[model samples]
Structures are given as structure tokens and as C-alpha cells.
Target: MRWSNWADTSSVCGIEVAEPAATAEVSALLREASEHGRRVRPIGAGHSFSAVARPVDLAVDLRRLCGVRVIADGGGRVRVGAGIVLGDLNAALAAHGLALPNLGDIDRQRLAGALATGTHGTGGRLHGLASAVTGLTLVTPDGQIHATAPGDGLFEAARISLGALGVVTEVELATVPAFRLRAEEGPEPLDAVLADVDAFVASADHAEFFWFPHTRVASTRRNHRVDDGGGRPLPRWQSHLSDHLLGNRAYELVNRVGAARPGWVPALNRLSAATLGRRTYTDASAQVFCSERSVRFAESEYALPRAAVVPALRDLRAWFDRTRAAVTFPLEVRFLAADDVWLSGAQGRATAYVACHQHVRGGFADVFAAFETIMAAYDGRPHWGKLHTVDAARLAELHPHFEDFLAVRERCDPARVLTNPHLERILGP
Candidate 1:
């Protein structure tokens, strides 16, 4: 069968797939593969734009291993199956009067994929998704089942191991009580926001902005925790209009036009910026945090020091002005606090994430390459699930615990059964 990632940027053909429903079944499959010396790669929802999850020999699909199990009645801890999609997990948690502290804009990724890739959201005071993990149940390449938690040495590395240490079958996450968010979003002057980006980020519980190239306007969102009851939400019709019609359908048409006429991109982007009118609403945390993303695009994101965000955006804007690159997609900027997870992009330093995207039909090579060059000066850490050219040699310098994580990987998969070309490139052979 053929397997392709959600972005359709990476795909493999004629690979054997195994769908194991139980942990014991997964162990059996891995043991047999280990004895035969056959390579294996576990797959989630294939949401990664990179080739990290591209299976070489055998593909273990974990979709059947889903569903949430509450660790205790009111302990705020849940053991979630690795196969569960984040959206589903969020709903389950909401039903239990609990929630993950933070979440990325899109929630289609499987729990394991999000945790493995160090997925994060925008919040100067919050850490990445992996930080919420208190425990993990992993099946090593040799079929050994190990339950690990903090202080286990392997736990930190395994949290964001890019699926190298082993296959994560289940994750125990520390959750928060169910909450609502009062979201204030609208267009703002890009110059003003960039002039004091730090203050802007610190002003809210969660804040992010998207700047359209060739436009001085920035579409900004600031979400703050709010009382659960007596909150106002966008009417159903208006919500559908904004999320589906303008956000996806019209956005797709605009990209199509830009792809056809590169010279008109500037005007199109200006129009797109103008349509982001002001709106305020209150909703459940998950509903407010995530939006419908039906438009297809390829993206490259980098996490840099919090202080580098303004300078990086300035350089990027200059590049767009100098090269007249016709990109329809807006540049997304977000923030996250420092974390201790060994391979996390935000590890050890407060981070500002800059994500650049291009319509799938548009040319992205030059744009992404130029963006990478600009980020390099800031010592940016590339998101593992996103497109990037950095390799192990440079990665080692970027990550303080790179060698330690490698040691754990070596111990877990001595035969290197869980590695692929992408893994080898980033983690070394």
C-alpha cells in the first residue's frame, strides 16, 4: 500500500502495514521483526510535513490502540493511547472536565506524533505538549515493554525522541481543569506589534500573530482564560462563514490566483489582510485554540530565542521586499516558555516560533531556503515535524543534550531498527 503524509510532501509505496490493536500484539510484531532483522517504523496520523514517519520496511499503524483512560477520579491525570488524535483527546478530556494546558492551532495529529515532534502552542508562560507528559509506555525495537516516568533518565529523551528511542504506545499526561478562553482577534498595525513584540506576547495568556507579505497589517489573536459560564461565542452562521468560507474556501481561491499570476501576489495579500476584521468571542479552550485548517500548504518553522523574533521578522520582510517573492500564505509567529525535554525545540530557552508557508501548488524552494538562512543567524532550532535542512552535526551544537539523547537511543534500539533516512540525517547513523 502507499502511504503519504497529511501535507502530501512525503510518501512511500509498496510497504507492508501492521495494525496491532493491543500492546501485546505490538510487542509480538516488533519481536518478530527484530529477530528477522527487518526495519520497522510506527505510524500515527501521518500529519508531519517531514519524512520522519516514512516507513522503510514495515509500517505499524496504531489507530486501533486509541481511547482515554482516567488514572484517577479527580487526579487530573489521563493515560491516553498513542493512536488517539489530539482533537479526540481534547473532546474526551473536556467530557471529563479536564484539558491539556496548551495545544497547537491544528489538532489532527495523533497523540504520539505530537508528543514525539515536540508540538507546541503560543504562550510565553507555557511549555510544549511534551512537557505535559508525566509518564510513557514504550515498546522498544527488541520488543521490551518499559514504563518510564520522570527521573528515569530515559523519560526526558523519550518525550521528544522523534520515534527513535522506541514506539510510544501510551502517554500519561498531567491535565488541567476544563477552562474557557476569551479570544480577542483582529487586524493590527504590523509596525507597532513588532516594535514591542515582547510586551505584546506578555500581555495575554496566549497570543500569536500572522503577517501577510507586502502588507503592513498583522492579524493578531490574544486568548485569555475566562469563567466557563456566561461566556459569549460567535453565532453558528458567523463561525461557519469565518472558519470555512473565508478561512479555507476563499483562501484557497486566492492562492490559486496567486499561483497563476505571481505578479499580483502583493495586491492579493493586501486584500487578504484587509479582510481580517475585528472579532471577540469566548469558547471552550480547545475550540478557541484550534481552528479548521482545510487549505493545503507546505510549511517550515523554526524556534529562535524570544528576543530574536523582531529582528528575524525584519530580515524576512526585507528579503520579501528585495526578492519580490510572491508568497500568498501569511507568516505565523508564536511564543513558548523554556522547557527541559531533551530534544524539544524550545528546550532550555524561551522561544519565538516563526512559521513560513506556501500553497502546495506554489514555488517554495527559494522562499524556504531564504527563510532558513535568515533563521540560521539566530541559532534557530528547526521543528522536527517541519521541513528543514539541518543535520546531526549542526543539531548537536543546537541541542545541549543531543549526545545524551543519542545514548538513550543507542540503548533502546541497539540494532537501529526504528531509524530511517530522515532520522539518520538529523540524529546521525
Candidate 2:
């Protein structure tokens, strides 16, 4: 009954128990765990970068307890069980001509889990997945069920609690009409790209880029809203080639070769950047945001001031040039508007998301540390579910409402039964 994270990096303690099949079943399990003074953690597909779902005593798998429940008008919002995977939600919503407004790089996470971490996508004009949540039904430590929405103080705090406040049994998301996006993808020189970064960021409705470290090349992606006029979806075959073949399979092979021979990183990076070709497709926004990420890897991401992206990339490139840190994975850059969620990376100011990944076999300490050090200089906030070394005290300095968030957590789950070792490190006792 050992527990391993999505990346299979953590497996020191804990065991997987039965996954509850319904909301009542989850309520009962939480009550039982509370009576036994056992730490209960609900795991949703285990797709998080942090050990948010890692518990020493018990892990409750939520995949079975998932489906959409009509909450309001047929077109408004739907209540989703915590275990409902994003793919399932997407399919269901598509049937209803609705969808959560935004999504992240991948959509394998269960609804509650995704909400807990404030998982996001790049959109200066839009908000995170957590913001799409209109309400939440949580099983508190005392076994009482509390349902909260827009006006409740609990709503804001619980929406992105990193699984520290309580077990989110179900979530109600404000869905929008399933719309199409015209996606444009191509390569651009990193320097030339950043020279007009602000303009480029403001040009597209949703823009993101990935810079291949050690090379001057980058892949730029833009997804613009398209009129609902009809066109056949990209053929299933083409979708497979674009997502699975080129994005995952071929990309994995390149990273594997680069990881095996560190000295070949620069050449591989150039090839990787050069391989980026222009492609256009019209599909659901969620479909466009997600790409197949089959290759195993660990990630670290931080949110810096939007203005700091170019300088940060420059500093990182300088380090990669002088150091032996040979990383073949491209560095991702995304933008986000300010948010009020206490621990949200985009809190209080527009943010530039800087994310880095390394092959599972590739040791990441040095390069990650280098990135962290540089981000720290810019007062960056780490993504709640991503890798970081900061603790509550350091985090308190960054989050204006840190104490207020803790207060809400205390009132919502006084015993702190939902807190785990990882929570202890980040939120403290």
C-alpha cells in the first residue's frame, strides 16, 4: 500500500485505501477517519507536482466518485463530484455545449484536485480554473457537510486551499458555451520574440511560448477566439499526430537523448527549437489548451512580475551558457492577470509564469535552484502544486492575506485533520 506521486518521485509513506463511489460514501469515510484521528487525504488522479495528496496514514482515491449534476439553468453551471476527471468533464460539457472557461497544460486532474491547487492556463483576459468554480461542497473534519458559494468567506479560501482546509467532495463550476479557438503555433528567435514580448502578449487572446535553453530559438503559440461558423474538427488522425506523435513521442525521444548525453544538449535544443513548425487548428478551447504529456518529468514553476520575464529569461540563458546544467526541456512562459485568492501565484499583480522541467532521470537540483534563485530576486510566488523550498513564514511575506487564509482554514477545519506532512512544511503546524 505504498503511495507514489504522479511523477513516482515520492513513495516513502502511506497506503491507498478504497475509493468512495459517491458523496455519501466520502462523507462516511471522512467521519470514520476523524473518529480514529487518522489523516485522510483525497487523491484525484495524482497529477499534482506537489505532495498535496500524500498522506502518511490513508489516501482516498476519488476517481470512482465522479459525474456531472445539473445545478442551475441547463446552461449555467454543473456540480461535479471531486473525482470527475477533466477529460470526463470536457466530454460531458461538450454534450451540453458548455465548458469550464480555462484549463491548464493537461486535463487529467479531477475537478476538486484541480480547484484545490488553482491550476491555470495562460490568458491575460481570463482567470484560473479555480475562478470558474461557483460553489463547493466539502466534508469538514467534524463530518459536517458545508456547501459554499460566491458570497461566503469560505468560498474564496476553500477554492484554492491546496487540500489543506478540508476534503472537497464536490465542486460547482460556472461553465461557458463550448467555443472554438483558432490555434497558431510557430517558432521565433528568443531575442527577437522578447523584444516585443509585451506587444506579443497583448496581441493574442491567449499566448504562450517555450524557449529552448542554450539556444536562441523559441516556439510561440497563440489561440484566438473564432466565430462559431462550422469546420470539421481536426481529423482524429491529425490530432493524434499533433498531440501524441510530435508533442509527446518525438519530444520524449529528443529529451531522452539529451539527458543521456549532457554534452549534446545545445545541439539537441537547437534542433528542438527548429523542429517547431507552424500549424493551425480550430477546436474547443480546452482541447487546444491540453497536449499529451506522456514523457515522465518533474516540474518547478514560479510567478514573477510580468515585466521581469525578459530579464529572467536572459539571466537563465546566461547561467545555462556558463554552467554544466544541460537541460533539454524547453522553458515555458505564460501570462496571468491578478487574482485575489490568498496563495494564488497571480495574486495582486499581473504575472509571468516561468516553468522548467527535467527528464525524470535527469537530476534537477542545480538547475531548479538556479531558477529559484533568480525568481526569488524578483519576488516570485511559487505555484502551489509545483516544487519549492519556501515555508509559511517566507510565504506569509509574499501573500498579503496569508494570516486571513489560515484563520479561515482554522474555522473550517479546527482539528487540521486534512493537513499532511507537506502541509506542515508549507502551512506549518
Candidate 3:
């Protein structure tokens, strides 16, 4: 069967798909694949837009190794199988009165995929989702399952290694007590939003903004943590209309229209901006953090120094105007605290994430390349799971612990059993 990622941007064909139910089985498969000179790639939910998870010789679909393995004390630590869906894991954790502290809006990714690609949510003090990982069980090139934790160089390297290190079979996450969130969303002028971005980022527990290109307006979302279910959530029908109908279906239709008439992008963005009004509700933290994202798009995101965020946005806007790019998708801006993980985008520095998207109908080469140049100017690091052309040379320059991560990769997989062409491009041959 042909294997393709969710956005259909990355695909690999004529490859063997393996479903090993147990860790030992995974080890055995690894040994077998290696002996036969076959490359093994573990495929998760296929949510990544990049070829980070694309299989060359064998695609080990780990969904078979699903579910929570252990829920450690009320201290809120849970060990989960790598292939468990983030949504399902949230549901399970909710049952135990525990929850992940932060999560990206799209929860369709499997745990392994989410952590591998450095998937994240928006918050000034919060780091990417993978920062929650306290330990992980990694299957080495030699078919040995090794569990790693902090302090050891292996733990840091394995956390966000982009699947170039090994197969992540189990992840131990440090969770938080189940909490509630009060979500407030409204439209604000893009210029006004950027003017006091630092204050805006600091005031809310989580803050993010989306600015449709060629439009003066930005839709801002701020979610605050609460002691209790802060207030009533939206009624079922209201939610259906707001989330399913307007967010996905209507948005998709707008993109379709924009794709057909490139010149109409400015008008469509204005109308889209006008349609977004104020919305407020309170729900479980997980419910408020994750959103329905059925509309497919190809994206490229980069992590910049927190201080460079407003400047970068200003430059991007200038580029959009100068080139008169026919872009209909809004630019997404978010923030994260610095972390110690070896390859995390926000590593060792406060970060602001900027992501641009293009509807899947056509390739985003021109704009994506422009954006890449813009990001490169700000010393930004590309998100692993997103689209980019940066290779090992520039990457080594961007990441301080680059050589350290390479040392660990060599130690863990000396034969390069866990690599593919794309990884070879980013991590070196």
C-alpha cells in the first residue's frame, strides 16, 4: 500500500509496512531489517508535513503498540506507548485527574510523532510539548530497548531527535493536575497586537494570534488557567457552528475560492477577518488547548528569539506587500520558554514561533522560500516536522549542542539504521 502523510505533501511507496504489537517484536524486527540491509522508519499518525517520518525500506506503523502503560502517583506522571493518540491520551489522563500542561491545537498526532517533531502550543512560560517528557524508551539500531532520562546526554538527544536517533516506543511524561481554562478569542488590529506583544504574551497563560495576509486584522486567542471549570462551555449547537462549520468547512471554502482567483485574496482576507468576533468559554484544559483542524494545508514554521518576533512579523508583512504574494492563509504567531532539549527549536533561548501556511491545492515554493530567507535572517531554527530546505551545515551552526547530539546519535545507531534520505540531508550522511 502507498503511504502518505496527512497533508499529502510527503509520500513513500513500494515499502513494507510492519506492525509489531510488542516492544520485543519491535526489537526483533529491527534486527531482521538491519541484517537484510533494509532501512526501518517508524511511522506515527503521519501528521508531520515534512518527510521526517517517511519510510525508505520499511514503515513500522507503531499504532499497534498503543495505550497507557502506567499512571504514576497523583504526582501526575504517566508512561504511554509511543503510538497513543494525543487526544486519546488526554481523555485517559482526564479520567485519572491529570493532564498535559500544554498542547498544540492539532491533537491528531501520536505521542511519538508529537514529541519527535517538537509539536507545541502557545505560551510565554511554557515550552514545546516534548519538554514535558521526563523519560523515554528507545529501540536502538541493535534491537535493544533502552530507557533514557534527564542529565544523561542520551535523554536530551532522544527527546527531539526528529526520529534520526531511534524508534521511540514509550514516553514518560511529567503531567499536571487536571485544570480548567478560560478561553477568550477576538479580532484585533494586527499593528496594535504587535505593538505590545510582550505585554500580551505575558498577560495570558497562553496567547496566540493569526493574521491573514494583506489584512490589517488579526484574530487573537488568549487562554488563562483556572482553579475550577471557569464558566460554562459553549452549547453543543453553538460549538458545531463555530468550530465545525465556520472553522473548517467555511474556511475550506474560502481557500478554494482564493485558490481560483489569486487577485481576490485581499478581499477574502478582509471578509475573513470581519467574520471573526469575540468568543469566550471555559472548559477542561485539554478541551481549550486543542482545536478541530480538518482543513488540510502545507506549513513551514520557525522559532525565533522572543525579542525578534515583532520585527520578524514586520519584515514578513513588508515582504508580502513588496511581492504582492497571493497568499490566503493567515500567519500564526506563538511563543515558548527556553528548554534544554538538544534539538528543540526553543533550545536555550526564549522563543517566538511564526508559521505560514498555504492551501494544499498548489505548492508553496515561492513564498516558503521567501519566508525561509526571512527566518534565516533572525537566526531562527526551523521546526523539525514542518517544511524547510535547511540542511546539516546550517543546522550545526544554529544549534550549539549540535555536535553533542551527533555524538549521541553515533553512539546509539552507529550503522545509521534509523536514517532516511531526508534525515541524511538534515542530520548528515
Candidate 4:
């Protein structure tokens, strides 16, 4: 069989695949794999651009083990199958008047995949999705089934273990009451936005911006929490036109053109930045948080101390000017509060996540490498699911609890059954 990630940046062939429908089945599969000395990897939605989910020996598909079970009424908590996609989970939670406190812009990632890779949304006061995991059900290599929650030795490490510890079959998440968001988005001078980026991040419930390479403008988005009934959503036609027709289809064409004519990228970027006119609308929290993303691109994101964002952007701008690299995609900037998850990017400090992207058809090696170099000066932590050259040795230096997390991985899967080349590279064998 063959498998490839969403961005087509990673793929594998001739791998044995298993679809496990229940926790017991997952345990059984793991036990069988261990007995035969066959490595096992839990495969999710493949949304990661990195090789994190690339299967080697056996790919354990968890999609069948999916559904949402309310643990308490009135949106307090819920036990969800790790395989449920975020979009589906959001709709399920909405049906129960509950919702995850934060969500990334793309909602196609499986719950486990998102948490495992430390996927996050933008908000200076918010932690990543993994922080919401109050409990988890893991199946270790020897078929051991362990149900862990806070205070349990394995909970924090397993939260963002890059599938190195074990297979996460289910997760118990703390949820918030379903809410709405009033979204305000517009174009602004890049320098001005960067000058007060911290203020902008702290000014709203959720905030982010995108800067087109070679352009002096940025498109900013600020979402504020509102009462459930207060939302005035965009008309269906307008929503489709903006998010689908223009955002994806047109954007795809634009990137293709830029790829074909690198010299035209600057003008194209300016046009792209200018077209992001002002807009405001209110919608359900999930609807406002997530958007349709069909154009595929490889990404490299780093989480730095919030204070380093402006200087990093300035350095990046300088690099672009010096090299005149024709990058077609916009650089996305988001913020997050410090978290305690052992392997999370924002584990110990307020963070500014800067993501650089290049269309698959364009050259990205030099640009991403340059971006990584700039981020390195600020002690940046690479997003585990994105492209980066950092290895476990350097990761150990960056994460204070890196060894501690390794201790948990040792205890859970000492033989390293739930691992791929990527896991070995980032977490060590």
C-alpha cells in the first residue's frame, strides 16, 4: 500500500496497514506487532507536512475508533475518540452546546494528530489544543492499556509525544460553552503591525496576521468572543465566494503563476496584499476559527519568545531584500500563552508562532533554511509537525522537560514500537 501526507511532503510505500475499530482491537494489534517484532505507527488524518505520520512497518488506522461521548452535561467535558477530525468534533461539540476553547485555522487534522504535534490556535491568553487534554487512553507496545489523567506520570509527556510513547486511542477534553466570535480582518502597514504586534495579540480573544513576502502590507485578523445569539454570519454566497472561490481556487492559480515567473512575485505579492480589504462578520466560534484550505504547500513554523517576533520579522525582511527570494505564500503569525505540556513549542514562555510557506511547485529549500536560521537566534522551538532540521540533541537543549518526557516514553514503550524515522530523529531511539 502507499500513503502520503496532505502536503505531499512525505510518503511511504509497501507498508502493512491495519484498521482498528476499538481500543481492544488496537491493543490486540499492538500485541501482535510486538510479538512479531514489527513496528507499529498510528496513522491519523495525515495533515502534518512533516514525516511524523509516515508509516514504516504497520500503519494502524484509527478512523474506525471515532465518536464523541459526553462525560458531563452542559459542556464541561467529553471523551472523544482520537481519530475524530477536528471539523467533525467541532460540529459534535456544537450539538451539545460545547466547544474546544481554541482551534487552528485548518480543521482537517485528527484529534490525536493535532494534540500529538502540539497544534495550536492564535491568542496570547490561550494554550494549544493539547492543553485541553485532561485525560488519555494509551495502548503500549506490549498490549498494556493505561488510562491516564493529570497527576499521572505519563499524562503530560503523552500529550505531545509525537507518537513516540504509544497509541492514543481516546482523549478526555475539558470543553467550554459554545460561543460566537465577531471577526474583524483588514490590511495594515506591515511595519506598523509589527511595531505593536504584542499589543495586537493581547487586544482580542484571538488574533493573527499574514504578511506576503516582498510586500509592505499585512492582513490582520482579530476575533472577539460574543454571546451565542449575537452573531451575524456572512451570507452563504459571499462566504463561498471569499473563502472558496478566491481564497483557495484563485490563490492556487496565483501561486502557480508566481512559480512560473519568479520575477513577478513581488508585484503579485503586492497585489495579493492590497486585495485583502477590510471585512467584519460574526459567526459560531468554530466557523470563525477554522477556514477552508485547499491549496497545498509545505510549511516551516517556529515558536519564539513573544518579544523576539518583531526583530525576527525585521531580520526576515532583511533576508528577503538581500536575496530577493520569490516566495509566493504569506507568512502567518500567531500567538500563544505559555503551556506546561512537556513537548509543546510554547512550554515555558509566551510565544509568537511564525510560519513560512512555499508552494510545492516553487523552490523552498533556501527560504525555509534562512527562516530557520533567523529563528534559531531567539531559541525558537520548531513545530513538530512542520519541516525542520532540528534533531533530538538540539531539541533537548530547547525543551527544559525534554529528558523528562523521554523518561515517560521509556516507561510506556521501552522497545519503541510507536515510532517512525521522524520520531527517532526528533525524540531519539
Candidate 5:
């Protein structure tokens, strides 16, 4: 019933806002919008940096329609309301001795939203979150609900539609028996360790690293399968100190100082990376996958060939050395194998994902631009949920199934009822 004239996403990009409660309401809303010749956009938690969720006319917020339900245990799949956040769902899954096969860095966004944009985490042998989706229930432009699954022509396309095709109501996710992960965190020499990033990625069940920008220091994380030993959880106070204080608070101070005086960033980076110390813990799969990122920063991430990471990062370092712009936040590097999703960044390519972030109020343009330039040379595919400036023409070159996805979108949304201006620009009409 209410709309924001102008809104900004988590990354501070301008957007429009609309609220819708359920699939039926969103269906009727889209139909009415089609009659009036207006565009409709469905938004989740506004976690994306790209304008994909921005609408010029109608914006549909699915926040109120979130819940987790078990549709079929025998089939090893469950139906989750599209708007359910990953954090909430994981808790529910824990109760049922079930968990998602994989997860991204954070769990703040809606399940449908994360899959729609091909959001992913790090694992050489694992696929992305979208790949876990065995089927989905989508509300079409004419207010018809369709259940899609593998082998269905519309299945692959709907798996990662970027909210351009229709409003997704519920998704059937393939799950695994709940498992525990032993997580280890420590500081590593940036140059020495990166010499074999590929091998390291392949060896670890889950591997991700954070390199301090403007410095040769990085934090390495490796998680592997572990027996369910009865290890007690970290005390709330200790967890808060380690995650919130040391990880976010100290990080914020480091950025504030570096932003004010660029020259101080390098030493700060070195110290910050070292300050992570060494940590070891065991937790549920989702708990291990999620990390608290309270420090506000804007990020741009691209997935390139696994072999391209070192050279691309070297090129980025060179750019940083030459440019006057200063970046304080760390750069995160992750890995993922190729996936079947049409719009997935790692589609058909064993990829190394490089993410560059800058302090929210700092000058991120130069560093982000430099990264973009380096990635462009390596046939990089930008994450649709992250910050980028690629349109349909550029995107088509990166994705092999681009045209196929478009055709499916056309069939599902002939009138483009769920499309926003940003979706149109990237996927075209």
C-alpha cells in the first residue's frame, strides 16, 4: 500500500520500493500493472549492489511471505517460501537434521533472491546455492502458478532468472543430512600462499581468503568435514568479542584511519591481517558458512578461470601501487566449480572469485575500476548481485546460456510484468 519515492540498496544504490504480502497479492499486482502498462519489480532484502531490484514503476517486496515447510522428506526436498532468509531457514533446517548443500558468505538475503542472482560461496568440488534448487513454484505474469524442475525447459532459466521472469513463491531445495565442519582461521603470507591457490582450493572442502587491500597480507580460512564431537559452543561473550569486536570493530577503525590517511593503509593492513591470530572451531554447516560482516563497505566481485587469480591479483596490486586512490578494506577471494544455472557467474568454468571492497565513505571508485579492468582481461563474469556496469551485450558474452534464459523468460513473462528498468537493461525486453 505504500511506496518509497526513492530508495537505496545495501550498497547505497538508488532504488524504488514496493510492498507485497503473498503470491496471490503479487500476482494480482503484476496483472494490474500490466493492464496499466507499468513495470513491476520483485525485491528481497536489498542486499545486491546492482540495480537489478530497482523499478521505475512498481516494486514488490516479499518480506511478509517468509516461512519454511517440509513438502516431501521422502524425496529429499523441502518447499521453502521464496522470501525466507537464509539465516532463518538454516536454523529451521538444523532442527530437522537437514541443511543446504552449500551457502554463501552471508545469510541475510532471501533464498529466492540469492538464487535469482546466482549468489555463491567458495568450494572447488561444490556448486552454488541455485544448483541446490531441484524445483520452484513461480507466479507468472497472468497470475498462474507453475512448478518447475530439472528437465523442464523453464527449470534452468527459472533457477536464476534475476527477477525478470516472474514472482517466485516457493522453491524446492535439495538438501543433505546435517553435517559438521571444522573451521580453521589464520594469517598467511599473501604472495607465498597464493602461489598455489588452485591446489589449496581443490584440497580444502571449503576455502576462502581475505587479503588486506594495499598490502601483502591475507587471512586464510579452511573448513573440512569433521566428526560430530561434543564440542561446546563458544560462549556468547567470547563469540561477540571474536566476531564483532575483533572482526568488525577493529576493521572499522582500520578503515577510518586508512581513509583519512592513505599512506597508513599498508602497515595497517599488515597489522590487521596478523591480528586475526589463529582460531579453530566446529559448528553446523550453515554456522560455519556464515560470518558476521558488520563493517559497511561496497564490493565488486568477478569469477574468472581458476588459473587467472594470481595474475589478475598481481595486475590489481600493480594498479594499486600506481594509483593515488587508497583502499582500506580487505579483498576476499573464493572458488567455485562450474554450475548449470544459466546466469551463474561460474557457469561452465572452474572459477576463482575475487571480491574487492572499500570503506563505505572512502573512495572505492578507483580501486573498483582497476579491478574491473583486470578482470575484463581474463574473461571475467561479474556477480549479478554485486556492483557492476555490464549490460545485456556484455553479459551475453560471459554466459553461454544467455539466449536460452531470455527465451524462457519470454515464455514466462510475455508482457514483462515482473521486470524493472535494471532487469530490462541487463536481460533486455
Candidate 6:
């Protein structure tokens, strides 16, 4: 069989694949593969952009092991199968008047895929999805099932192991009561926007900005929590027009044009940023946080110290001028609270996430490499699921608990059942 991830950046051929419906079935499959000296890679929905899911021997598909299993702690939390897609998981949570603490803009990822990749949403005081996990059940390569909680020695590593430790079978998430967000979005000058970064981060429950690479304007968002019980969602017609039509289709068409000339990118970006304009609405937190994203692109994102964002972005702008690279996609900037997860990008301090994107047809090497170089000065950590060239030696220097994570991985899967070339490159052989 052949497999490819969502962005089509990574692919693999001639792999054995298995989809086990129950935990016991997974254990048996792992043990069988282990005896044959066949390594196993567990993949969920193929949403990651990186090669973390590229299989070396057997691709253990987990789509069948999905959906909510139990609601506990008086329904404030949910224990769900790892393979449940985020869109479905959100709906399931809504039915119980509960929701995950945060969500990234894209919701097509499976629950396990999101957590393992350290997927995060935007908020100064909020951490990534893995941080919301209070407990988890992992099936080691040796076919042993072990459970972990927040204080457990292995808990930190299990949350965002990047599929290096074991396969996550189930997750116990601490959810918040369903809430609503009042989002005010509009364009602002880049200078004015960056100058008030601290005030902006402190004022909103969630905030983000998108600056078209060649333009001076930025689309700013301030989403504040509102108590008016889950106010009205966007009208279906308006939502369809703005989200599906303009957000995805129109954006795709513009990128197609940008691909051909590349020289016309700056003008096109200004037009898009100017025309996107302003809008305000109140909706369920999930609805407000996530938007449909169908236009495929390769991306590189780095998490930097909160104070370093402005300087890094400034350097990026200078690089663009120096290289005159014409990029059409907006540079997205977001914030997150510190997390204790061993491999989390935001570990140990408040962080700002800056992401750069390029249409599939356009050249991205120079820009991606440039930003990677710029972000490095701030001790940046790459998002595990995104594009990055950092290796284990460099990574070990960035993460505080680097050795501890390796120690855990060594003990859990000493036979190296859950590793591939990519893990070897990034986490060492």
C-alpha cells in the first residue's frame, strides 16, 4: 500500500497496514509485528505535514478505534478513543455541554494526531491541546498497556511524544463548560499592531494576526469570552460565502495566479488583505476558533519567547526585502501559555508562534530556511508536525527535559518498534 499525508509533503510505499477496532486487537497486532522484527507506525487520518507518520514497515491505522467512550468527573471531562476526528469530537463535546480548552484553526486532525503533534490554539494564557490532557492510555511496542495521569512520571512524555514513545490508545481530556466568543476582526497597520502586542495579548481571551508577506497591513483578531450562553453562530449563507467560498475557493484561485507570475504577489496580497476587511460575530468557541482550510500548502512554524516575536518578524521582513521573495500567503502569528509537556513547543515560558506558508506550486525553500535561521536566535522550537530541518543534537539543546524524554522512550520501546528515518533524524537513532 501507499500513503501520503494531508499536505502531500511526505509519502511512503510498500507498507503493511492494519486497522484494529479494539485495544486488544492493537496489542495482538503489535506483538505479531514485534516477533517478525517489523516496525509499526500508527497513523491517524494522515493530517500531519511532517514525515512523522511515514511508515518503515507496518502502518497501524487507528480510524476504527474512535469516538467518545466515557464522560466523567460529572461530565467535565471526556475519555475518548484516540482516532476520533476533531470535528466529530467537537460535536460530541457540544452534546454534553463540554468543549476542549482550546482548538487549532484546522479541525480535520484526529484527536491523537492533534495531541501527539503538540497542536495549539492562540491565547496568551492558554496552552496546547496536549496540556489539557489529564490522563492517557498508551500501548507500548511490547504490547503492554500503561495508564498515566498528570503527576505520573511518564505523563509529561506521553502527552506529546511525537509517536516516539508508543501509540496513544485513549485520552482523558479536561474540558471546559461550553462557551462563546465575541470576535472582532479587521485590518490594522503592521506597525501599530506590533507596537501594542502586549496589550493585545492581555486584552483578549484569544488573539492572532496575519500579515501578507509583501504588504504593510495585518488582519487582526480579538476573541474575548462572553457569558451570553453560546450566542448565535454565523448565518449559514454568510458562513458558506465567507468560509467556504471566499476563505478556501477564492484563496485557492488567487494562489493559482500567484504561482504563475510570482512577481504579481505583492499587489495581489494587498488586494486580498484590503478586501478581506472587517467582521464581528458571536459563536460557540469551536466555531469561532476553527475555519475550513482546503488550500494545501507546506508550512514551517516556530515557537519563540513571547518578547522575541516582534524582533523575529522584523528580521523576516528585512530578509524578504533582501531576497525580494514574493510570498502570497499571510504570515500567521499566535500566542500560547507555557506548558510542562516534555516536548511541547511552549514548554517553560510564554511563547509566540510564527508560521510561514507557501502555495504548493511556489518556491518555499529560501523563505522557510530564512525564517528558520531568524527564529533560531530566540531559541525557537519547531512545531513537530510542520516542516523543519532541526536534528536531535540541536533539539537536545533547546528542550530542558530532552534527556528525560529519551530515557522514557528507551525504557518503553527499547527495541525501537515505533521509529522511522524521520524520528531517527530528529530524535536520534
Candidate 2 vs candidate 3, lDDT winner? 3
Estimate TM-scores for all models.
Answer: 0.99, 0.96, 0.98, 0.98, 0.93, 0.98
1-429: candidate 6 lDDT, tens digit per residue = 999998899998899899898888888888888888998898987877789988988988788878695564445878899989999999998988888878899788988888888999999999899988989888888888888888776788999988888888889988998998998889989998888788878879899999998788989999999997655677899889988988889989899999887889888998889867798889988999988889999899999999999998899888877776878899999999988888999999899999999887787888888889999988999999999999999999999988999999999889998999999999899
> In model 5, which regions exceed 4 Å deviation?
1-21, 230-232
The global C-alpha lDDT for each of the candidates, from Candidate 1 onward, is 0.92, 0.82, 0.89, 0.91, 0.81, 0.88
Model 6: CA > 4 A from native: none
Candidate 2 segments exceeding 4 Å error: 13-16, 230-233
Off by over 4 Å in 4: 73-75
TM-score of 2: 0.96
- Tens-place lDDT per residue, model 2, 210-319, is 98888887799998888776544678998888778877899888888887889999898888788777788888877888877888888899988899988888888889
Q: After superposition, how far is residue 179 of candidate 2 from its true place, in Å?
A: 0.5
Q: TM-score for candidate 4, please give it.
A: 0.98
Ranking by lDDT: 1, 4, 3, 6, 2, 5
lDDT of 2 at 142: 75
- What does the lDDT come to for candidate 6? 0.88
Off by over 4 Å in 3: 70-74
Candidate 1: stretches off by over 4 Å = none
Would you list the clashing residue pairs of candidate 6?
Answer: none
Please give the clash total of every predicted structure, in order.
Answer: 0, 0, 0, 0, 0, 0
